[model samples]
Target: MPVGLMLVLAVTLVFLDLPLVVIVLFSFNSSSSLSEFEGFSTRWYRQAAENPDILAALGLSLTVAAAATVIAVVLGCLLSYAFVHGRRRVTRPVEAVAMSTLVTPELATAVGLMTLFTTAQLALSTLTLIIGHATFVLVYVTVLVGNRLRTLDPRLEEAAADLGAGRLRTFATVILPQLRSAIAGAAALSFVLSFGDFVTSVFLSGTEIAPLPVRIYGMLRFGLSPEINAIGTAMIVLTVLLGVTGLWLQRSRRSTTTSNPL
Candidate 1:
């Protein structure tokens, strides 16, 4: 690469990572001061662990994310199958609407969800939060899995049929295996999005339960603290781990396919 391009890349990376680096560093600070780090300590992390509200919120977030991911993956895979196999005249318009969710402002989606729930007399609660998350998350799953499906040779299914395999058996043994990597990636992405979601959670969460991001925002109303930094650092760590795990799964699947070629 050119020296100028390398310099620009370095600067961009630093610009993006500096804030996260500061948060991770300050999470271990002995003092509450954000400006000056007074030495290393795990005090903030311990405080966060001890906080009942934070723990509850964290648990709720995990539950919602897991549920939403499962829903997104199942619905998304089915939608992807439809997009590939169904008539284009029927699927094309639906695909456009589905993809539009990606570009739709999250705030707008949140507001729309809130309004729809109110109009339908559905209470804003954990269920609503999961529904809101899965609605958008399914689009991601569909896109990834649909792309994979499009690349697949349809003759595999036909060959299986010729061998006396039923539709369900063919899908279970052949199609699902091929989609493992995409499904894994989609599930990981869905979980991350749901866990980190603040706007939708803000609008949909009930008085009894709030996700971690919403809980963190509530904490900020009191002012910044090292405990908040600790929580933020923990969330960052989880997101990175999920992303790495997804990539590892995808690569491993590819390697297995290459090695076996069956």
Candidate 2:
């Protein structure tokens, strides 16, 4: 039964990931249209490089993702700390409310955010999209940081305090270092979510603030452009590289801790 289930899972992965494989392969096709699988060529890649609009949209996406990740990390860490500490009574409800957004339909969140921003007279721009993305990413960050905090031994902080370290110093020197994996994981997830976001970006982006996802959607709507496949390939490569780096960092941390038991 277990082997059968594993086979099923493997089949599912292959089926789901087939589009990405096609995108990567089509990215190198000599043909301009993705429908025609011509001989291998890097023409689409070169075209993507020359397209200034694509470059601008990519830059905007990275900027919004970075900004949203920073905001999510800061707010998430604080909320995780508060909830992990004795202030659970106050923070638990807030945490629940924040998490509810994660399970809610994304379109619903986008509509609600748009309405709130409209009523508040907040202009729709990269900043507004960052706020919208942050709202969703915060839930992920909270889960990451909170799980790490739960695994941690509070006595370590107590020991630091006993050694005359102030609360801020203890947190900086002890807590943050231990939660490094969680922080990195959270930030990476938040950045990826914000970068590839479509629904929220569509609602929040102004005339001049179109991000990569929006650009890709427009290209897709026009038809399957090989340039879009090239972009998709690049995004897949980036995500894989970042995921591998995070895994290495996590393993390195675990190795160091195992080798040096204090």
Per TM-score, the best of the predicted structures is 1
Each prediction's RMSD to truth = 1.3, 1.9
TM-score of each: 0.96, 0.92
The deviation in Å at residue 257 for candidate 1 is 3.6
C-alpha lDDT of candidate 1 relative to the true structure = 0.92
State the lDDT at 150 in candidate 2: 86
> CA lDDT of 102 in candidate 2?
70
lDDT of 2 at 119: 97
Candidate 2 on 1-262: residue-level lDDT in tens?
6999999999999999998999898899897765778698998899999999999999999999999999999999988887787477887797788778778999999999999999999999887988999987988998889887887878899999999999789888999988888899889888888888999999999677799999998878778788888999999998887778767777876787789744
For model 2, the stretches where C-alpha displacement exceeds 4 angstroms are 1-3
- Go through the candidates in order and give each one's C-alpha lDDT: 0.92, 0.87
Q: Backbone clashes in each candidate structure, one number apiece?
A: 0, 0
